[model samples]
Target: MTNAEQPETPLDAVRALRAEFGIDAGRVDQIGRLLTGGDFRTVEEVVSLTGTSRRTVEAVFRALEPDLESSGDGRRVQEGRAAEYRCLFGAREPFGVRDPWTDDARRDPAAVAAMAGLIGAAPPPVQALDHVPATAETVVKRARFMLDGFDLTGAHVLFVGDHDLTSLGLFVAGGAPGLRASVVDVDERLLEFVGAEAARRGWDVRCHFADLRLGLPAALRESCELVFTDPPYTPEGVQLFVARGLQGLRDHRNGRVLLAYGFGERQPALGLAVQKALNPLHLAYEAMLPGFNRYAGAQAVGGAAALYVLRPTRRTAGAARAAADDTRTAMYTHGAQSVEASGGLDAQAAARVLELGADAGEKTLLVGDGWPADAPGRRIALPAFLGAPLPRNLQDHGTALVNLYPGFGASAVRALLAANAHRVGLVCRNDLPLLKDAEGQREFAGLVAPKFRIVRRLRDTPGPGQALVLAERAEPEGDAERVLGYMYARAHGKLGNAWREGLIAARKAAGTTLTKSEGRRAIEASASRPDLLERSLMELPLYLFAVLEGDVRRSVDALPG
Candidate 1:
């Protein structure tokens, strides 16, 4: 008899499911046994029996739901305390809740609900963007699992990218008292949201803006004990994110990196490619928990990814300094497609201008990240406008085409000024919201009012490109302290006079010739000051030079001159 014309039975149904839906033989057998037996089963039971992921089990049960419902004999039946799935021919009631930890303490519904609401309120994922948040449920479970490993009570945890809102979940979970969690991301909206949430909860969470494609912010490097990141699915993307995260580790030897990546069963090659990317970083593959992460919309990997725990090898510790610069730009989903190029210029064309402009001795510098690395011009590489002094030549009257992007504000302005780029041209996307707001324009004016003249403010939305040239004045009142503050504060956090004193003492104790990094560590270990955060030690000198006007500035001035 033909398969379709054969008499229907439990085994026949299993065969038909395999033929039609591609359900595996094991699952088919389990389902067939459940159909034949007069046993009621829960979703958790089926999941346990088949040794499949919860989501996979759910999908299977969902696919079979219509058929079971049509049977009229299958129904949800309450067995004891909870509802179970029962089908015809002794089928149990349909499975209900999937919570298997019955004995575990119940979660605070209000806290959980708050997180869910916040995640729901976030803007929709951008097309071709690398960021995609896991489901709220998945985030909660992930937080719980992550927290179980270590007591975050006195820990400083760093999240390389928090599109998943794992930081938020950890904050709300609340067991760690002296926990300091910080996040660095390219998205300003996410940063603002996270900052607001931290303020609301009175948590010690800090946010910094940066594009990992350039590098991890100097302020964040070597600042935390633990690191977490959910990077793009691309192999290069994973490597870059992991490398950047490894940079944040306080002690590379003991630091752990938790990474999330997934690939479809049919995409073994893709998974292998991702695995290969890890080798160069010299990470010891500690553990890879299968199906540890779940996504709401990513159905390709069955809406899940695995969590990989990697411990840095000695090689990783030794090569930490070179990790950030090793990443390539085409790490996102769309490669060059997501890049925003304007002014009658495709991405490649703009790259050409950037490359050739420098070669032609036009003093051209690309003021952004994600540009084709193969492009000719050198990147400014200053993710933020920090106090790193510019080369004296660029500090003269040069032309700078600033890429209008995330870190394009006070820092960009400072970078241009310090570089002494006479004509500052802003190259932005057509719809960029730079000069639209009155307040923003006023803020921009306040930053450039004294030193530079705004030659023209061009509005070019829905057009080809917009350009604004800020020309340097003949007799510019270069606010030395303000400029120094911008430079120092951008690179370091808040630094005050006392902090500087402590740092100096620390340096002297370590034999005055200690390197900048060594001096900072010495201060961190020996200083007794409660006035500065551990992360703020590096900023003290900047604070002394910038904020403390007379005595400290005189002291700073007297030392060198």
Candidate 2:
């Protein structure tokens, strides 16, 4: 057909309306070209094109009225009916859409086993998170399906949240070569676990610590082709995480976001509310596979949730810009238990705080509980509980201690170590002065007796809780301290199981007759407090003496008998 014969199109109509409304000709031209190309022009796009604020974009849409319908709660206003619209860039169904997991992907026994192991190694789920991680089989299926459906071979994938270990499953499945996977999470334990496992497997994976509510890391913004997230099962949580994932898309034109969200049948309204929340983000809903994710223990949703494949439109970009400053910290199912919750101490936790804070003398005590009365030096409350971001003051403190209490474990330990405290201690409840059982002794040895000395062990004659002190051993002196600092810094301040292997390697290289078990014991003894600074002060000296003492035999001789 000749240009003259061409019918007045949506773009032509937009142009006519633009002239009638006296909108900027250049802005109208930009909008016409984009919409004619079958794209959604969001408030963000119009603002960027015309150099205006969101209010102006809203005014333009309102002026257009029925001619251009606003989608995603008005963030994305399009020329056609909402049902006919796909994405801001163009309309395209998700390529290679398939049932959850292909048979071939699920048949690999080794991959399945590896998935199980990874899931087992993940940090224990926080009940407050409503975290019932999917079964290993479910996780393997989800990974396989996502990789295949998304064609993620050799792609740089970003995981906004990874409690399910889907990213690890992708690495283990092994079909996607040269895959560069990265994770950003508030949980330090998850970051540590993923980092160690990735290093062990030699996969190109990097772990970062971030709180989504605070915005994404600047380095990761617009840096990935795909983003996968299984956000908290709340409308606010879903929108925040999904929006963050969308922001991480390197190229919004072709980038995709895979979202896992589910609501109970009885709570259809809740599910609808969640779906509606996506309107502001302006993601093109490509396809949704209901009950695609199967959890092992989430009875609230009948152990399953749907998977959503979303492609970003220009509207998505605009929504992200507008919502960036509007997002809040409490976007979880349990507001009080959310990672943003300020950890305040109860009476028992407070009592232990007094004991831990009693000898702070000229040192900062970053306690989970606020300022203990008569506490020495300065006392500050830190959000050191499960899922909370590590306090910024951790690096400033000389000594850090967490009074062992219910609902606190390795996660707390990880936070203390990450703080870079020079000395770290774990105050316990058991009577350390009279403990004798081998099993009991082993647990205490893991914390105090060996690497840490009993600075104070007291029970005020049937007091409410036992008070036992385990301070960091004095820093190494001379060459030993220098070498120790170098090695610990190289290890990044956390002594995980990998450090044990490294210690064993150092021992063998020194020609030491140290058994692997002995080397393991030494590493464990050095890690009693598990704080990098604490471990360096105590064990790195011995490690350096074994590895760097000039002559191999001399190095072996140098290790304490």
Residue-wise C-alpha lDDT for candidate 2, range 417-478, written one tens digit per residue? 33344566554434432243457444443432222333544443113443333456434334
In model 2, what is the error at residue 212, expressed in angstroms? 7.8
All candidates' lDDT scores?
0.56, 0.57
Q: Write the per-residue lDDT of candidate 1 for residues 1-561, one digit (tens) a residue.
A: 586786364334434545654534444445534533445565555544433445554554554453442234342222331122223223433322243221121365655676688798776665445666786666666666657777677888888888878888787665477888888776656766776777677777777665676666667788888898888887777887888888889877677898988876446898999998878888999988766666765655656678888999888965655656663545677513232421233466465345422335555555555456665444665443233445554444255656543323323444444444545555544233346676766655555443455665655421234334344433322233332333232234444333354335433544553344543453344333323334432223221222233433333332321
Candidate 2 residue runs with Cα over 4 Å from true position: 1-141, 149-153, 160-165, 171-174, 183-223, 235-254, 272-286, 310-343, 346-369, 372-410, 418-470, 477-481, 486-561
- Model 1 error, position 229 (Å): 0.9
In order, how many clashes per candidate? 22, 2
Per-residue error at 23 for model 2, in Å?
46
- Cα lDDT for residue 181, candidate 2: 87
**Can you tell me which runs of candidate 1 are displaced by over 4 Å?**
1-110, 121-124, 318-323, 334-388, 392-394, 403-419, 435-454, 457-561
Measured against the true structure, the TM-scores of the candidates, in listed sequence, are 0.64, 0.50
Candidate 1 positional error at 471, Å = 6.1
Maximum-TM-score candidate:
1
